[model samples]
Target chain A: MDEEWIKTTDKKIINLIRLTRKNTLDYINKDINVSTKTTRKDLVTNVDKSNEQFLVNNIREIDPKSKILGEEGFGDNVNSMSGHVWIIDPIDGTMNFVKEKNHFAIMLALYIDGKGILGYILDVMQNKLYHGIFGKVYENDKEIFSPKNISLNNGLMGMSAPLLINDYDNMQSIAHKSSGVRIYGSAGIQFISVIKGELIGYISHLKPWDIAAGKVMCDSLGITVTTIDGNALDMVSSETVLIATKIAHKEILDLVK
Target chain B: MDEEWIKTTDKKIINLIRLTRKNTLDYINKDINVSTKTTRKDLVTNVDKSNEQFLVNNIREIDPKSKILGEEGFGDNVNSMSGHVWIIDPIDGTMNFVKEKNHFAIMLALYIDGKGILGYILDVMQNKLYHGIFGKVYENDKEIFSPKNISLNNGLMGMSAPLLINDYDNMQSIAHKSSGVRIYGSAGIQFISVIKGELIGYISHLKPWDIAAGKVMCDSLGITVTTIDGNALDMVSSETVLIATKIAHKEILDLVK
Candidate 1:
């Protein structure tokens, strides 16, 4: 809970994300040496595991007492956000990373005693780091202006493709009402768009790692991060989640409910 | 038909696009003066008109005898692609340019007696220009390799959101068949992705300006650009289009037909 601890952790996380970006790019481009945990024949599959391991190992060294939950099963099997909890999605949008090589992201969030203390989402291709320390959000070094809390009708939305196709909770109708819909195939990248006000919201069926960093960033911007049923989300369960500008939140909730 | 003519035209077009990028960004970011054909209070509306005018005027000087067809009505209303025809979409995704300031493009294509001679699609935000001359495609200075001719099941797809929602020609089912779907709100950007082999195909209802440049680039890369009905697309009308790898083209057509 100490301010000093938050500041130092923020610095370390940014550096770690940069390192992850370099190493991942190296691995993907086949520039990394095979001796450092991979076969040269197929570099993509090992990326999630190796990258998550890299993040977990560095995070462990940075905060020895914290419980880390990672997407590739490299960390603790955290079921509760008690004490110091670090939730990581080392290579979010793996398909995009493999197929497109452009829209995926790397994310980390730190919660202290169930309170989101810090979060980071690195849009690797764009080389932009969006983060929140305590309640203020920043893009790289500049503090982000709070996105206008526009309604669903006036804003662009992002959602998982399957949800829209299935019309889950009126998603097809929701897509119609929105100015447009974009599916970048990554929650972290979608969160960055929402944080920057390019997308007014993102709705997806997401796991804790998929939605955890987003919850921290959205809360910092006064954007709503909640379950589709308009309930608070615990940082453990997979749920249908909607992260949006405040008014869009209420509008989307009304339509789906 | 001359190689020298195509080479010179390519150089001139690239220079023109660089200038267009500078002016467009200035207009959007409010760095340009109000005297430059816009009122300071609302610049978004004027962008399409002014940008098209800029391109049209330059094209006239570059190739005096050529006929121009422009999206913003700055040029001819010709119904035929004959003798040195240039089609332009100065701001291909005005909604995106105004809404997200990303995923939009400036497209220009030259058709000589019904044959695509040269084409360009500049993804302004990412600063990528996908272009073709005769039968070769290049990204900036480097020639682009042909994308792997993957099947529909092996590749990602892009579609217009409305079509996907309406299930036009079983689009929702098609969504399930492909690896996944993305809706990026601009035909030109989507075309760039396909040219780069990021998306195997893009299906959309597009205007002449929207599909002309794409036709040229896709043809150069040996990618198939056709009507959803598996017919050739003449560069003079709006139509439901599919720009895909060869195998994926047949697969997608079989689904809809």
Candidate 2:
């Protein structure tokens, strides 16, 4: 993507995200009926589906040729990361949305020919939008500086419930070594915490939409975005994801092994 | 205290809490320095001491017979809660204040003749206040009804860092059974979440001041607030505190045993 074209796309995407925010708030202020998803613990709501459709329609109008991989099945049947692809989770942390009415996020990512070109994660309740175009990342409009490479022993970490319960990848030990642990129940919110230095790292099992935008934002800040074992993640599947500062990543990976 | 006298004192305490808010915000917006308390992770700032003094001075002027037990040493040294005793944690979650600039709380409670009479927990950054006098509780000015007595399997739970890592009182198993686990790093914030029905319960090792205000608030809602083993908490020392909805309390106590 050329510089001018990239800038134009970024502006359009930002506008679309702001529109999504308005729609989400409208639904929340009104009555919402929630339903369960895959398991008794997993949740989905009418608002989630409506939000995804709204985002998909706008995104399609912005770039008709682009393929969308959305959480609510309103997007294209995408299999390969070829050409232009927009991945979105209209409402990440659906459980939080249904239960707490906070801590949920809207995330979107654009990849061109297998390369990430842009990303956005909006913390709806807080009205904080973290975005990155190519190598530049910003929170709202202010440029964010990379935090010091603090190690696990000196910083806080975020973990998923399933991983902690099962001791998957020795996560229990990794959590024990970190200064402390936090679980906000949202991948996008957790990513924002790591980027802002509020949390040193975050690990969880995430689908592509759950982490696509967050990964792009982290990459721009030189934060480590990889598997729990320091391996590359498949962008099209659910995987154990880890995002952290450089030293914290190394420390966590060492413990996982 | 009789109903008429209690109602009058409630109004006065509420006004005092609102006034204390202004002073705390002034310190936060200004440039301030922080120092460590017992450990590197434990922190205290000048803002904390100033807030405590401000609250104490106002309380003293409001009621001269009161004995204050404050986190800072400015309050009167009272060994027994036999009279009008005020317990205050100037800034709960001090580490969060120095680091995240959020998730900290201001807590105050009044015990009349060893019985809790009034409580306040102010979420400074969000500007939300939860207070109760005797059996009536309010959030800001709106009255709060009792939350549903959801069990452990159906609601989120909060745990402390040390407790989670050590799996103390079989917390690991209890966390595994709950709908999910959350660690917001502040007992006051955790309590607010539980009272608001965002979390079903919260367990942590807390000092008297840390859980004092929260305990009083929970009591009004018919929520169970006690030790991990379903025993009454000592009002003058640190203990393993558990605050939860009724069914959740029984379920957790069973697991702990």
Candidate 3:
């Protein structure tokens, strides 16, 4: 696709995603009853299902041919990403949303033929969006330069629950080498750290929706996002994703391997 | 001490701590020249040292006989809690403060003859304060009941860098049994989680100032604050401190031992 066409489509999608996110935040913020959908562990609070359904319905209307993969099970069982694919995490940090009532985000990513085209990470409380299209990344429309490459020994890192304990793929070694480790229980916030260069990397075992948008945003900023073993991630599958600066990436990969 | 006397002293000390914290925050927020005081591994930013001095000066003016032990070496080299000993962590999460400008806290605890008389943990950005005197806990002047006693299997746990990596005293086994583990790099914030019932407990290798205030606050709320081996803590020494609810305390001790 041409640059101009990409820009136009990107602008439209960015505005749409922002609107959808704001609506979702507003809906949840309003007084409402909450209930468990399937099991106590699996919650489907009014906001969760509503947000996913809203995104799916709007995406279907806007691009009838695209396949949607959504966390709330509102979309199809997308087995392949052969054509246009839109991955949505309506509420990426449900526990944080339900408990802390904050630190959650709405993540959306668009991919065409396995290449990330656009990404959006909406930080609800701060009302700042870390977004990107093609080669450019932005924080509320202001262009942000990629942070200087920092090594594990000099910067903090973010690791998820299971990874921090099990030493899954030698994560224990990586955690020890980094200056510190932070776990905020939100993929969107973790991605924001990578973009802000506050953290050297974030490693988590995540679903497609949890990382799709973040992957696109990181890729645009010259950051590396890959599997724990330094392999390209299959966007449609759950994997141990490591998003980091170039130097941190090398150190983590070495330590983990 | 009588209950009424404890309550009154708690209120007075809490107010004083809040005022001192606000003054320190304002001073640091202003642009000032800073130089490294120690190895890059152990930074003593201008704000850290100056904040301690500010607290020391104010404490001496208010209570000339009180002994203050502060993080930045501006206060007395406290070896005993013989009188009205005040333990202060001018900036609990200095790295976070210097880097992200958030997540750090000013912690103060007043012990009268080796007994905790008052404690304050201030969340600067949110402007919320968790404080306690005797057996009553308060969040910003409102009474706060002890959070539901959650078990290790049902709640999150917090671990510091060394504990999480080296599995100090078999922390790995205890962490594996919990729902998840979170590391936020701030002693005050981690203590806030326990007091708020967000985490089952937090374990960290810390100094007297780093944990003195948290120890008092947690103990007042009926939470266990002790060394990992279930020994009483020496207020003047650095050790692996474990703060948790009753059930989590029992479970973690069993697992780690």
All candidates: DockQ:
0.48, 0.54, 0.39
TM-score of chain B of each: 0.93, 0.96, 0.91
- Provide TM-scores for the models: 0.94, 0.91, 0.85
The residue ranges of model 3 lying beyond 4 angstroms of the native Cα positions read A1-47, A95-102, A124-128, A133-144, B1-41, B133-143
Model 1: colliding residue pairs: none
Give the C-alpha miss distance for residue B88 in model 1, angstroms. Answer: 0.4
Candidate 3, which CAPRI tier? acceptable
How good is the docking of model 1, by CAPRI class? acceptable
Q: What is candidate 1's local distance difference test score?
A: 0.86
Write one digit per residue (lDDT tens) for candidate 2, span B115-163.
8888999998898999987687888989988888998887888888668
Task: List model 1 lDDT by residue over B65-102, tens digit each.
Answer: 99999987889987888799999988887667777888
For candidate 3, the iRMS in Å is 2.4
TM-score of chain A of each: 0.93, 0.97, 0.92
Arranged by DockQ, best first = 2, 1, 3
lDDT of 2 by residue, A1-257 (tens): 58898889789989999999998999986888788879877888888899899999998988899999999899999998988999999999887887678889999999888778899999999999999886988999999888778988778888887787677899888877776678899999999888888888899999999989988878888899998778887688788998999998988888888
Candidates 1 and 3 compared by lDDT, better number: 1
Please write out the lDDT profile of model 3 over residues A1-257, one tens digit for every residue.
Answer: 56786677677777776777777667765764456655443445677778788888888876688899999889889888888899998877776666556678888888888888888888876778888886788999899888879888878889886677777888877877777788988889899988887787899988899898888878878899999889999888888888999988988888877
For candidate 2, give the docking quality class from DockQ. medium
**Local distance difference test values of all predictions, in order:** 0.86, 0.86, 0.80
Error of 3 at A182 (Å): 2.0
Off by over 4 Å in 2: A29-31, B2-40
Better-scoring candidate (TM-score), 1 or 3: 1
Clashes of each: 0, 0, 0
